[model samples]
Target: MPNQKKTKIVATLGPATSDKETLKAMILAGVDVFRINFSHANYDDVRERVEMIRALSEELGLYTAILADLQGPKLRVGVMSGEVVVSPGDTITFRTGKPFEGNAEEVYMNYESFPQDVKPGERVLLDDGKLIFEIESTDKKEKVVAKVVQGGPLKSKKGVNLPNTNISLPALTEKDVKDAIFACSLKVDWMALSFVRHSEDLMDLQKLIEEHAEHKIPIIAKIEKPEAVENIDKIVAYCDGLMVARGDLGVEVPAQEVPLIQKRLVIRAKKARIPVIIATQMMETMITSLTPTRAEVNDVANSVMDGADAVMLSGETSVGNYPVQVIEKMTSILKSVEGSELIKVPHDPPQIRTVRYITKSVCYHAALMANEIGAKAISTLTNSGYTAFQISAWRPSAHILVFTSNKAILSQLNLLWGVKAFYYDRFVSTDETIEDVNAIACKKGFLDVGDMLISLAAMPIKDKGMVNTLRVTEIESCPV
Candidate 1:
């Protein structure tokens, strides 16, 4: 019904783009979803933004998605007395102690949580790898001794980085759990987990969601660490979606390898039919300038050309002066590139054998059938966006219209290709489902009186695994 585009755009909200006017502009400029970064805003701020988005959508008679990104266990150096400048030849002491005056010789970490975590021979990076230090001696009572491996001036509360070090820390910190609960209460569409290392990380959060939220929220795993990349298959199985977080990932891994890793991540996710988003600094210069640089434009176009489901804007929209302009530019780029024949990448669809799960097989079969029939569109009523994603992977020419009663489902669909999501009340009967879907089709100009329509839905509403049927019906006439 709606215009079909392969690549979606997710715009982050911050002081620059949080206002109603800016949000409206962003929607008009083609932001498929709005990202609320919990790391920056509080509950009240997010609530207000959500309310505004809902109101704007209602006014425009358009559907949009809201993604709440949870900040997970952000590790940082505790604090320092003042600015501690260290040159190349300086030696620094990084240990737990009261704030004291120090020069190039040594510096003190005022965090009580540090000593228990750091061990001998472990490397600690300061200011996100602008400086590096190796621990020499540990004093549980006094301070630990360390020599600067790389040196730079250290400011108060700069981020700390640990590469290839196994630190014992909870996947979900207290703040993360609290924020997760709050996000569930708000009924957000997607919950992006930061710093996810393994499949168990998602399982733990899923349990917390069940216990506290009493509802299932789709988890989007953010791949910003090496561990997550190494254990990606399991993580993808456990989560609903994946995000290529290139910023911290660039810092954590070799910068030159990020592009290669991004390609691998996208390909792997495509095979599973799981939506993947390319996020962080896709167009960093748009944060200050009205237009993106040539390289940045190429970066975005290349991601779309690579078959990424979506590309996201972080600082470019969150704190950038040209938030609306950036959205417009990205939308334009996606439209232009997606229209070109070059956008079609050859992919070998995986062979799915008949499995014990009938629903899974049904989904695969329906997608194959649609492609073979050369249908103009595929429509499914799904509580999760999985069914739509499965259909999209078939590379059919048809657009996908995923209908749902849950607003959360609509939001999570923002990162999927060829998906135009709509929300309606859960159907109480088969007749209602048919009539509702047909009415929507007519309204959106997706069907004519005699057009053939394919419908897929799970029967017996209470059952979760009942999505195993497809029916083809011809539209008789327009509803009165």
Candidate 2:
């Protein structure tokens, strides 16, 4: 088996990493999850990548997860006949469906509700906030007139962002519906909804998934908008995971506030026992150079210390010159930070009312008990992978062994921290499950003949709410 890190790494797949050998090497380099970006890949491309990952996992006897990221409601300007350059204090008009041809006076916008949603004096950011424009007025014909506050070369099909306006748009677009169905057909482990603004946005995608998918896949909501921050608690209540998509989020909200927001989101997800990913620009400098700047290393370390389950790479692993080197560097940094004294402190779970306090208390005690007794490993039987997530959040010293009968749940466990998941059918009795766990642990070298182990589970097999049992026993003492 390949050596694993406690803080998981999620690497994106693209032109540089589409081959089988490169991907296999990345998996060996400690990549826990592979993300298929729908914005850049077609349906066929996604299917091929999914097949490759599954095949590699089988050949290597390791579990890896695939996340299909849906591009939601991305606003962009239409084509311009020629590149137009505008300077400061220049007045321009953005007319709905009006293509600009060699003129800087007016440009085309496809979003019909732009004029109705935006008001005068609101900031209009284009090309990833490179050019800033303030709305001067709006016309009855659904056009927005603005004066350029900061301007540069404007190209065709550039993205537009309304930092100060809350535009009215559906969470799921027409293309997203098709992509969601196609991804579900491929049996993706997780579906990530981009630019998720509220809890209802997640509900809309959930209904769509239920309509198409035979098995329910988990949803990962990407918090990339200011509205998402305002409704984070409610949004997190509905999704299985959360991703701090800082690329567009930094553009949508204030740049200085993003760091604090990242810490806040990680804390919220940890308290709720949900997997959270910190994504975008994690190792950006590595794309060009083999080494990352000192600040980037500290950024990743701080994210892990803040309790994020995973840190993701976008272009660094996808289209960069040295993809494998980047993963290795990331793995090294995470390992060094993990062993430092900064990570030795106790976990701080939130004291919120809506969280499952009982479950949190139970998982924390299980880890404490394992530490107190110096057990070789901690084992649990889980169906939805919830108990394993709780244990991972506590960041215990002992390795976690999770046994589940569901294959989908088994694949979903790949995103967890310090967890080695296995599938076991035949849940006849609680004693049988414990015996199986001990046998597997000993057989897999996680435990020895005389090593002590900690076993935790809910009695009666399907009992809900809190874990009801915790036992400490010698591996050789458990009856087969």
lDDT of 1 by residue, 298-405 (tens): 999989877788899999988998998888889888888875767564345446554525665666666666666755566788776667777766555556777887
Per-model lDDT: 0.77, 0.85
Q: Of the candidates shown, which would achieve the greatest lDDT relative to the real structure? A: 2
Q: On residues 379-419, what C-alpha lDDT tens digit does candidate 2 reach at each position?
A: 98877777898898777778889988878877788898778
**Which lDDT value does model 2 have at 442?**
74
User: TM-score per candidate, in order?
Assistant: 0.87, 0.92
Candidate 2 CA-lDDT value: 0.85
Q: Which ten residues in a row have the lowest lDDT in candidate 2?
A: 345-354
| TM-score of model number 2 | 0.92
> Model 1, which residues run further than 4 Å from truth?
1-3, 78-83, 97-122, 140-142, 339-358, 365-374, 406-408, 424-439, 446-454, 457-465, 469-480
